[model samples]
Target chain A: MMELFFKPKSVAVIGASKNPKKDGNIIVNNIINSDFRGEIYPVNPAADEVLGKKAYASLDDIPGEVDLVVIIIPAQMCVQAMEDCARKGVKAVIIESMGFTETGAAGKKIQDRIEAIASKAGIRVMGPNCTGIVSRDIATTFFPIKDVPRGNVVMIGQSGLLAAGMASDIVVNQSLDIHKICSIGNKCDVNENDLLEYFGNDEQTKVIAMYLESIADGGNFVKIARKVTPKKPVILLNGGRSEAGAMAAMSHTGSIASNARIVDAAIRQTGCIRADDFTELKDFAKVFSTQPLPSGNGVAVVTAAGSVGVVVSDLCAEHGLALPRFGAQTIDALKGLFPDFMPPSNPVDLWFAIEKLGMTRALEAALGAPLRDPAVDAAIVLLAGFEYTMNAVEEKVVQRIAKECGKPVIICTLVGYNRLRNRIVEELGRDLPVFTSLISGVKALSKLCEYGIRRHRFGDR
Target chain B: MVEFRPTEIHGLPGFRRRFIRTFSGIPYIDVLSHADNPAMPDSGSENFKIADPPCIENEPMPLNEIVARARRENRTVLTEIESKQILAQAGIDCTETRLARTRAEAVSVSAAFGYPVVLKISSKDITHKSDAGGVKVNLKDAAEVEAAYDGITQSALQRFPRAQIEGISVQPMARPGIEIIMGMTRDRNFGPVLMFGLGGVLVEVLQDVAFGIVPLERSDAAEMIDEIRGKKLLDGYRGQDSVDRSRLENMLLKLSAFVDANPEIAEIDMNPVFARSDGATVVDARIILRELSEAESARPVQS
Candidate 1:
């Protein structure tokens, strides 16, 4: 059923326009830009052409049968567009327009009318107001033209901006080869469960991230999420936490927002990692996608900065994440790498080593040094490519330490070198996810540790 | 071994007979669970400020006034919904409820919300209306509800003799939540001592209770909730989600606060506050309102 969306043979951009600023422009541009191999039609009569393709006056005029219709026309005209698409026998109409149900009584009336029309026609409409779906298999992105994502992590969300933002940050900023990003705005018809089920079966998609304002059709999402999370981590971020936000959520997505406390209980009961913010959603999505699930919660922080290290320690301790007491054999292994008097601690600070013995020993101590402590189940190394840390040996040392440590070793650096950052992910491979920000890196590690704790208490399931 | 001076019960000949007669069960067997007239110490600590220990404590009022008050509120017994509403003002969680002004409306509502919904005549006047046939349970459909409502109304009139018949209560038969009981009645000796216990059917039968003073914190409330043997269920044993314990703990704290705030309340009983996978919601509640007199006004309740 989901293959129809990803592998549609022909698609019609019903409200497709040449205006670069219009929502239709982005949808058309996204398709033109992607590697999607499908017949595309620009259906607008005002101009005989759109994006160099001959424009059809209406769905009735389109030369080929349209499997999907992307509509961004006015609300009054939307019902007509649906009728025309139905007459033309379009199987789906992706409405990228807003101003219905969400806008109170008048909007609800308009939306009810549209629902009736679509139901009569038997057309599976994605939304009356939504960002059309975007994917590697499809060139259709309803996001503002610029924010296209490419990665193995597929994010399905209620808020268009949230999905668009995730796509922008993951693809453009992180430079990840995201497999697909679907902005399921408003979720008038398709919801988290549908997309999650689709992602669960999608071979290309290795990880799933979702933002939900509410879950419709009961607890099916929870059951499916529980089943799929162990296969590949399903990172969840739920909005409507506050009372006012919850009430607003009902209008935002036709759901009761059904008492946030219940949502919280249900989510925890299902065993998905709950993300606190979008950064963690993306960060954890990437990390869990590539890294092996750690077997324990004990973590070792190796950093050049004392303030950052101590704060990380406090965060870990508060969250029940242990900074394990070092093992003797591990300490003995670390002694040779460290300067005199700087034997070994869980943090195993590298500031002193770099000051005296130089960058090579410091880098070795920073990366190669952390794994030596057997107490450390996982290691988080904080590095800022400053003058002392700029030596060419740092990346090489990190590479070796990560290779030796069977557990995850996440590299946290503020600076980005396209080649260096890309090289770390390539060399380290699935063992770790090198992050751009300290906050995200720390959060990912916390979730990894949380996953370990949950696994220990509840087994693999 | 260091020991204190012996008391009279300890030294008297046939001390066993006296102890058995004082604290024992039906045949006067010296059993702890059967303790009726509690050894005075069990009532409370010397410094613990309570009006009295758990007993039939009510303000002195003529039967006429009690009936009048019950009639004024249009109830047979102090109705469960009315009693709970009073508690909700002080931050208590009760089932979402609506009052029906007509019997037809009540019957229809009961049917819509599904069977097994609790139905009772609500009144601020009568205290034990359930005993007076003013309460009914688990009605299947509209006809049964209409019959039950009429039955309860007639019974209230027969028993109260003066209750001003208010509209009947049509409530969704309470969903199951972890059951806990909380109450406070003004005591003769100490003051208002709070009561906590194993709620539901166990409350009436087992009589398992733990008492504490008002205004409990999370720790104190948690301890009070766990004072009974059946509390192990809340700890998540044998493949069940942990009972909504955090909410249950809050209910305890709120109960203490409500009793402490309302000076007119002579007694308050919120029994079987059922908690489930979601949270604890109050199922049934009863409260006794005190009448103020100039003579009694010589001393207002403890500030």
Candidate 2:
């Protein structure tokens, strides 16, 4: 059903522009720039041609059957343009124009008219005030984000700018691959449950993250989410958490629960994770998409600094993960790698091991020992990958061990500078996510463990 | 030497005397004589049966008709007696209630129920009887009962001069036990959701409640009970006897079923439901029916 919107055979840009500054031009340019194997028809009344393509005056003037229509005109003209698209038998329409219900009562009247017309014609509408969609196959976003990596995480939300910003960040940082990003602005006709059902069944989507100002129908959302989350996980971050925000949410959308606790309990009962903010949402999405969920709550802290281990131990307790007492065999295995004066413990601090042996050997033994232990469900390796400390660091070996252990291995770095951080990310973050701090690393692992434990109880393989 | 807590044998003497006084057919001579050797385990902890109330066969009322009448009269909140009757008809236990119009009727009802009894002004216009000073508890004698009857009626009449007076209701005082609340409120999106929490004044101060959508299974009830922060208060706190959790779970299940069967019920507040080891009793209940929507009223009739 979503293929009509995403993988259209032909798309007609209703309001194409010749100037590069215009949103119309950027949208057409993005579609032409990406690896979209589809026909593009630019329609502009004033221009005969746009961006090296023959421009038609209207969607009716398009020569062949247009599968999807992209409208970026003024809000006043959107209803007539929608009528023209519906007459042309376009199955999907994405109205990228602003000034819908967000403006005031007058704009809301116009939006309601558009909805009635679109529903009567049986044409699916994406948004009236949105950036449209950014998919791996076809990109129609007006934003200037380039080369979003094609992978298995779909982000669909009400905020277009937030999705655009995160898309650009994920693509630039190479944190996680993006299969599809949609800004479901206003949700005049197409809402979250429709898109959730679509992506929940999409084979390309492994995990879904949403930023909901308010759910259109919370009970219906839970019903659909309960069915989808068993096979794939859904992480939602509700925005209207404060009293003022709750009041604002009433104007934004109609279905946010008055009590935040009710919404929280609903999310929990549906077997989905509720993230606190945008950063946690992105963090959870990255870890859930990249790492295999830990089978238990026992985490092994393998760090270079003992203070890092202590802080992380406290965080583990706070997050409901535990640092188990190492068995004698595991202890002996770690003791063999470290010096006699520095005995091995659950944390398996690598200070003396690196001082006596080299950095590469000490890291390899310290990281490998805990990952191989049966008692440890997950491992967090803290590396101070500075210029001098990581002179002989082997990222391939670390990544290979992480993959071979069959459990999740997350790496945190103490290297503060962006230049060195980029290098560390380039090396280790390719296979495993390299968190910037121990707190983030612990938080992600704890979430991973939470999913694993809940999956066991929910009995969803 | 072992020192037993004073609360270990609370109400025991009175309970034995009541048992002997009430039931003459049962043999109590041997059981009373063997009080010294209380270690006898011929029967498996039958003394716990003291908490069980006598079962009564209740005739189900015309709830649908009652709801329709309330809607016709444009009433949203049901009186406490009406709410408890609906609940009792649905198989949940409630205190025995009788409307007393005159002071002599109140006295006789109290004497029949074996005082001390409770009296409350019963009127459709008054939702908060206690707040209006329309409630009196522990009316120990005929003079006290007459005074309470007049006092509650006068206070209620003063609070709302135009309100119709339905006199006062005489009820047997419920036994002391754990106070817990079980209620249902209709959400705008989700139809009806059940709420459970610590009852009485602490319900507001603690704010320790858990909610679950109605039509709950046994597992959901158990989970809702366990999720509340005051769970330990019900599970025998500080050497006090624990209320039966199975009974509480059953009450939750029954309430869920009741809400599921009655869609017209907009809100049901069964606050201060005295939960005991044997069963739970609804001391006060309030059911608010959904108002008829404007759309329905505006629709043209076929006739």
Candidate 3:
């Protein structure tokens, strides 16, 4: 059912226009620019051709069968378009129009009529106000996105910000390795549960990050999440979790149990990792999709300065991560890298080592030894954004050692030159998870360790 | 010691009267038999039946009947006795409580259950018993029980003039221990959820509670117990005896099971449950029933 939306063979743009600024034009252009090999038909009464594709006056005029339809018509005309799609025997439709339930009662009535029509025709509607889907194979969003990398992470959102704003940013900046982004606004027919179940079974999808203002069906969500979480990680960011949000939920659902507390209970019960903000949602996905899961919550903090290491240790403890003592062999191995006056410890301070052997060799011994220790399940390498750190970033010293150790490693770089910092973020961060702050780095690593420990305790399903 | 047998009455076949021996080293029967009562009735046994002490061997009353009876009477709130009966049926332990319609019944029931005992107003209309002066605890003798019963009835009537007084409920005083609370409430999205926390100031002021969704696995229950900020207090603070944590977890699991089995229950509150080293006992309980819609009432029951 979901494949009809993502991998449709042939598609029709209901309101495709010749004007370059219109959403109708952008939708057609995005599809044409994507890797999609399917046929495209533009249904417009005014234009004879859209982006050089033959235009049809209506569904009846199209000669070939339409697998999916992307509707950009007025909200008032959505019901008529849905009726036309039903007559054409099209099973999937993405209505990217505005003025649905989010407006008021009058808009709600029109949405209800469309919902009735879709249900009767056995059709699945994606949205009444949204930017439908963005992926390497197809892009239906109004935003201009191209060359989407075939990455492993799949994002399911209930708002257009994910597909339009975030998708363009991530693709242009190459910040995240994203496979697909879906925005199901108003959720007239399709919802988060449908996409969760679909992506849960998707072989290419390794991590799922979701942002929802309200759950469509919480009971079904819990049931499906319990089954999917043991197999893969589901990171969620709930939009309306405040007391004011509870009031809005009361008007939406006409019930009292819509508070943040109950939603949190369901998340914990299903073992889904809860993200406090949008940054955590995306950052957690970046780390989980790239790094290996640790077997325990034990972490080793490796830093050049003692102050930053102390802060990292405190943040790790606050996140339920333990900084275990290094074993004798690992300690002995690290001692050889340190100078005579300085002794190696859990944080494995590398100031003297860096001063003696430079950044590349010091990190190779100091960071590599603890990562190889049996007591440490993960490592947090704190790097300063100075000219000295350029050698390590260029040599990929952290990346090489992290790969060899086979343990999860995150780098937090602060107090650095902007040029040097951007260089690290663009270079090392592309492969390994790198954060500008210690809290975010430690927090992301903690989520990985937590999930890993849970999986280790309860055998993988 | 007296051995009592089940007495066959006109229609009540399982009628029986059992003597309760006081663990507090006080003789209740002699005091009740000698106490003077001007308003006492000659035949107390005919009007009230002493509820049996809660034990594993006792046959649990049907839960649906308790819920249906409350709904039939146009009441959403179940009396404390009814709530305890429902909890006990779910395999959770609760202090035995019985309804006494008159002063004489209250005395005899308290005597049978032994002293010191607690008397609470059992009316559906009265929810805050202590606020309405409808509660009196630690009554050690018939003289104190008689005085406490009069004080409770008069105060409740003065407070809630039109309330329907269903007589006071008498139960043996539970020994002091760690105060724990466990409950279930229906969520609009997530069906039902269970909560566990320390009872007194921790829950009231700090709101130190952890919740788990219904139909919880054993691991979920264990996690809820371990998630609270005051969880370390459960392991014995200072010289106080630590509570039996496994027993508390079992009670939470049973609560989840009960909520899962009974969908009509809207909310349940078991507050100030006494948690001892050996076991935990629910000191007070309240269960609220969901108002059935017309379509829900018309649906056929599943076997």
Candidate 4:
């Protein structure tokens, strides 16, 4: 049933327009641009053709069976369109029209009417005010998203614009390897549980990031998450965590478990990682999708400056990560790279080494040695984007060592020229997870290590 | 004042079989209808005779009967005695509490349990016993017990005139130990969630509590115990003896099991469970039932 939405063979766009500026036009254009090799039928009584495709008067006018329908019409007219879809035996529908429940009482009544129709017909509805889905296989969102990478990460959100905006940013910047981004607004029928369960069993999905204003069914969410998280990491960013936000959630969904503590408990019990903000949501997914899970929580901080290493050490401790002492061989190897005055330790400060042996050699001995150490499960390598560091980025030294050691590594870049930093982000960021702040990098690595240790304890490969 | 006939027990739906199995030898199975007692009958001379100490080992508690009676009567709140009975049946330890219907019965019950007993007015209507001056703790002798009983009855009658006063619940004074609170509450979305925390100031002022969704695994129980901010206090703070952590974990697991088995229960509160070095004992308990919908009433109960 879920596959029909993501991999639909034929699709019909209700209220699809020929005008370039309209959402109906964008929806049709997005599907036309993507890898979706399905039949497209644009339903607009006023137009004979839409986006070079023949437009139909209604869903009944379409020739073949419609597997999926993307409705972008007015809110009041949605009941009629839904009835038409139900009569057409359309199993999947994404209602991108706004002015439903989120508006007021009259809107809620209309939504309820649409829900009754969908339920009676045994048809699944995604949203009443949402941008549907963006993936390599199909792009149903009104946002101009194209060339979506078939990455292993899947993002599920409740806000329509945020999910579409983030998808645009990620795709345009090529920051995170994303498989699909699903925005379920005013979740009338298809909820996080349905999508989560579907993606949990998906062979291609490795990490799932979710942003929910309210959970439709928490009991089922915990049950499914308990099973899915043990196999793959599920990162969650709860929107209504504060008192004010909880009040907002009540008005948004008509009901919510307003207690933040219980929500936190559910997250910890299911082993799903909790992300505090949007950046962590994206950053954690980036790290989990690209890097290998560490065997333990032991992290060796490899930094050019001592102060940054100290700050990272504190952050690591705060995030339940340990900065353990280096092993004898690792310490001995790092000592040879350091000057006489500075003794090598867990942080493995690399300013002297970088000045003496240049960027590549310093990283090879300083970052590479600890990464291969038996005592350290992961490493946080801090880099300052400078002219000298440009060589290492070009050589892919950090990326090479992280891949070779078969352990997780996160790089934090700070205090550098914009051009050099942009170069670093563009060059090394494509293959490795890079953060502008130490806390984000450390936090991401900590989540990966936490999941890794849990997996290792459960004897999962 | 209502004379309950033994033959009426046979009329209860699904109660005849279990009632016969549990109370076969016991004479005079007084079956009080919901009209007589809104919540449950008084402890001394009522249905399901109160064991002297109230801790009857291996005695199969009639959970279905109590729940059905409450639902039949349209009562949402279960009396404290009823709550303890349900908890005890789940294999969790609680202080032995028995009902005394009269002054003489209260004195005798306290004497049998030993001196320094606690007497609390056992009525479903009086949720705040202390506020209503219905609680008299640490009575040293029969004379004090007699006086306390009269005072409680008068004060409760004066406070809540229409309350269906069941009787006085008498239990031995539990030894001083670490005060812990553990219970379950139904979330709007999540079915039932269990909570663990320190009692008194730690919980009241600081609000330091940890929660877990129902059907918790043993590992989840351990994590919830360790998640609280005052978790270190559980490990023998100052000169106090370290609480039996495994025992606390077991109680939590048992509660999770009980909540999982019984979906009709809407909420439960077991506050001030004394966690001693040897074990933990629930001193007070409250269980609220979800209003019986047509679907829930028609569904077969899981034993």
Candidate 5:
């Protein structure tokens, strides 16, 4: 019954138009451009063809087996079109049109009619006010707004724009893999819980990120998020906090924000790491998708600047991540590299040695000391300038470090001609946490630490 | 005592928003502005004690004047602000409440509070009336709704008292939500410090409650909450709900704060202090601020 989305033999675009700028045309084009391994049929009243695809007068006129009927049309015509999909026995309908439910009284009535029609017909409606779903395997992006990324990061967001923004950032800014990005807008029918349930068993999905404006059903989300987060890291960027949050939730997704504290408490309890910003979402995804989850929060920061260590330790203290004092042995190991007065600590500054011993031993000492210490659970190596050469030793050291201790390592550096940031992700493949900024790197590691602790306590993934 | 006549705003001498924005705006004269109902209980409420050490050295120049002066200086201490000042002086820590009776009061109260305070009217008319104009908090008060206090207090007295009257209250409230009603009810339920959560307004909202025999301790207070039907929300559930029990325990501490502050508080009727990360404050407090006899003051602590 649900075969249309994943194994659809053919799909019909309900509001297909000849105009290139039409939302329906864009959806059709995105599917075609996505190399979707399925047949596409455009349903238009007057046109015989649309975007070089065989156009039918309507869903009933399509004749061929229409597995899924996706609509992007005006509000009034939607009910009749969905009724046609119901009549034609289309298993799934992705309504990418706006104006239903979101616009007040009139739209609410239209939305009610649509919900009733979809429910009775036993057909699932993705949304009445949504941008639809996007997948690398089959992209159904309406508006064709931005580039869809290629990798192993699956996402679900209530806002279509925010989801697209995330996808664009991941594709352009970082080297992280993108698997699936689903925008269940308005969520009239399908919501976060459904996606969580789906992604819970999704083998291909290594890490999943979500931006929930609000949860439609708190219980269902809690159940699904709990089950999924432990298995694989599910990073989230949830908004609608304040009355203590939960005010914006009404307009954004028609979700009750619950109490913001309750939401945070619930999400954190489920063993899911809630990202503070978009950068961490991709950063954590890039790191966790490839790197091993750190066993503990005890992190070591090895940077050329003392300020960097301060920044790292401050984050550690706040996030419940530990940055314990380095042992005499760990400090002594760095004594030769640093000035006499600058005694070594958890955030061991190597400004003294980088000029003398150069990258080889500085990088070695940075990775080696933290990896061996029983107290230092993880490492965040900060290197400035275009330092690809640093990665050579960093990678070699991390290889042994990861094997002996299951601690994650991150690198925050200024990427130059060598594209130092890019090379690290490619080499590690989620073997270590790598971020471009100090804040992001620390946050990602902190989240990994949080997930590690919460999962252990909850007795799940 | 009866000589303190109520002050009235004649003809709504409208305050110029533009004047507030202007640099040369001299506020020595009364710049007219509309007012509103309160979000919380009155500052002069029985529980909102003058915790600050008495202005023995510095004259207590009628705090309304001090508050008014502070408003011009952009550093006024409103009733709730002064309450906190009083509490700070007395070393009696209560839930942090921010007041906003008028723009000056709210600004003065907010200046004292960083973030997250019970935003309410400090009114005399309706003491227990939170739903009315007499009380409103958790609101971002920069929007300036002063008339709300009078509106609520008036609404309350008209609905309940009818003939009697009182002004408003704006308190920097705390959420000593793990409440055990420390007073005798006007109803048949008399004198037991009747702990309620599973039944009262809080339990209806938060869904956790209990009943203690009397003289609630941190433990007894904790135990009373065990009587709640929605104990799950209080107790840690599956990524669901959490109650900062320490905060609930602090309500007992606040009971201690009140009991410790004065010999009065013969019957404390503080219904709600919406629970947050921090401890509780008396949002809708109504203590019979009775003058104590020497013998009663000399009585041993109720431990």
Candidate 6:
């Protein structure tokens, strides 16, 4: 059922147009540029051809069976087009056109009519007001996101612009890997529950991140999430957690936000990780999608500066991730790499080692000590302004630490230069999660440990 | 009909049961823990006999009938005695309260309850007794009880002239312990959600609470208790005695069961649930039943 929307063999662009910059034209162009394996048939009565493909007058004119339909026309005309798609036996439809439910009563009536027509024909609709979806097999959205990073995280967002923003960040920054992006705007037909059920079983999706203003069905979502979370981590960032924010969310998406504490408890009850902000969403997505879950809440911090170590240690404690006191053997091993006068600790400050032992060896020892320690469950390596010698922080060392210790390592860099930041990010991000700030890195590790503790509590893994 | 099968999860501690119930064509699987089946009618557990059981025989009427009577009388709020009665019938520990309509009755009830009894004006209309000067706690003797009764009744009448005065309720003053609040409010989406917090007079000022959906399991109750910001206060903060956590967990489970069983119960405020080292007891309970519409009675409660 979900494959019809994601990997359809044949899709019909209902409002396909020849005019450049139009939603109908852009959607067809996206499918063409995205290397979608499916056959695209343009259906526009006014145009003879759209983006070098012959345009049919209507869905009836298309000879092949349509697996999916993208309705990009006016809201008032959506009902008729849906009926036509139903007649054509299209199983999935993505309505990118706005002015439904979000516009109040008159629009809601039309949206309800569309739902009735589609449900009677047994067709699943993505949205009456949405940005549509993007998959690795095919990108069906009109939102112009270029060179999308295809990885394991499936993002299901309620807001179209928020989905676009997250996709653009993943694509442009190349930080997080998003396997599937579905903008479930208005949720006239398909809601979070349906998408969660589908992607929960999706093998390609390792992590599921959602940006929801208000959940359509809270009880069922929690039920499905409780089942899905044990297998795959589901991280959600709720938009309307405050009263004023809730009011704004209502005006924006026409959704009444559930109480924050109630929603928080429910989210926790389902064993889903809650992201405090969009940055934390990306942070958690990067770690959860990439790194393995830590066995316990014990975190080891390795930093170049003692001040950075202090702040991150405090954050670790705040987020329930403990910085364990180093044992004699672990302290002895760490002290062997550092000066005799300076005793070794959990943080393992490498300020002197960077100058004495060079960046590569210093990083290797500082990170490897905690990673190799049996007392530590996870490791956080902090690097500051090592732009030129980023390769010195060997990927092999990080990978070896992960493989041997059966733990995850996170790196947070405090580089001021953008070129160096991007270089370090592109270099080390492939092996370990490279965070821009200390708090995000610590919090992400804390979140990973939280999932670890919860999964262990449920005896899932 | 459904059959229960014993299932063993490898390397796990508890005994698990898989119950498959099919309604229409959809099959629902419920994983239940069968650890420690609570023995009925005195299994020799601490104070189990003293607790009021569920109104099993139904001669004195069930909660639904009491709610229906209140609805017929056009009363939205239940009196303290009626509220605690409903709670006690659900097997929850509530303060032993007696409603006295006259001065003599108040003095006699206070004497029977022993010294250091608390007096509060009992009226269906006056929800906040403290604000209306209707509460007089720690009344030691019969003379003090008489004066408290006069003051409470006079103040309640002065506050709301049109309100009907039910009389004063006398309860033995509970020992000082950690104050916690257990409550339920009907959420628009998720029916009744239970809330736990560090409570008492400062509950409003503190506003530290954690909520959970009803029909909570033992693990759910444990997590709810640990989720609160002031959770450490329950563990004997600043030289105070630690609360009985298992007893608190049992209270939460009872609240969940009560909330789940009574669909007409719209809101329940069990404030100042005095938590001592031995067990927790409900000091004040307020249960408000659904009075919006007759149509609500047919609506299936969401779990």
Q: Total clashing residue pairs per candidate?
A: 27, 0, 1, 0, 69, 0
Give the per-residue lDDT of model 4 (tens digit) for A145-210: 899999999999988645688999899999999999999999999999999999999999999999
Name the regions of candidate 2 deviating beyond 4 angstroms. Answer: A243-257, A338-342, A388-397, A414-418, A425-427, B1-60, B110-117, B121-165, B214-219, B240-250, B253-263, B293-303
Q: Lowest-scoring 10 consecutive residues by lDDT in candidate 4 chain B?
A: B24-33
Q: Judged by lDDT against the true structure, how good is candidate 4?
A: 0.83
**TM-score of model 1 vs. true structure:** 0.60
Instruction: Supply candidate 2's per-residue lDDT for B262.
Output: 82
- Candidate 3 local lDDT, B38-103, one digit each (tens): 232322223333343422112345788666556554567788888999999899999998876556
Q: B1-303, model 6: which lDDT tens digit per residue?
A: 122233222211221111111111111122123223332212111111111211111123357666765665455577777778888888888888876655666677777778999998776666667888889999999999878877876676666544445456788998878888888776666666787888776766677777787767788889889988888888999998999888888988998888877877777788879998988888887777665666754554322
- Chain A superposition TM-score per model: 0.85, 0.94, 0.96, 0.96, 0.85, 0.93
Put down candidate 5 lDDT per residue, A1-461, tens digits, no spaces: 43366446788888888888888888888788775767899988888898899898877777678887788889899989988988888878888888977899999999899999988988887877776667665667674633555566787788766556655556555466777777888888877777778777878877888887776776456557767877888788877665343222211011212345345545544657777666666677777776666667788877777787887788778777887777777777777777777776667777677777776667677668766788877788875544635545455665665566566777776444455556655554344556666677777777777777665765754
Candidate 1 per-residue lDDT, tens place, A131-225, comes to 75666667466665443454577777777675566566555555455676666665666667787887888777878887876666434665677
CAPRI tier of model 3: incorrect
Model 5 CAPRI rating = incorrect
DockQ of each: 0.03, 0.10, 0.22, 0.25, 0.02, 0.16
Best by TM-score: 3
A375-424, model 3: which lDDT tens digit per residue?
99998888887989998899999999999999999988888899888888
Supply the TM-score for candidate 6: 0.85
In the order shown, the candidates' Cα RMSDs to the true structure are 18.9, 13.2, 7.9, 6.7, 17.5, 13.6
Q: Among all windows of ten consecutive residues in candidate 3 chain A, which has the lowest summed lDDT?
A: A245-254
Error of 3 at A419 (Å): 1.9
- The TM-scores, one per candidate, come to 0.60, 0.84, 0.88, 0.86, 0.59, 0.85
How does model 1 score on DockQ?
0.03
Which window of 10 residues has the lowest lDDT sum in candidate 6 chain A?
A248-257
Worst 10 residues of 6 chain B by lDDT: B15-24
Q: Tens digit of lDDT per residue, candidate 5, span B122-161? A: 4332333455545555645544333344454445544443
Ordered list by DockQ, greatest first: 4, 3, 6, 2, 1, 5
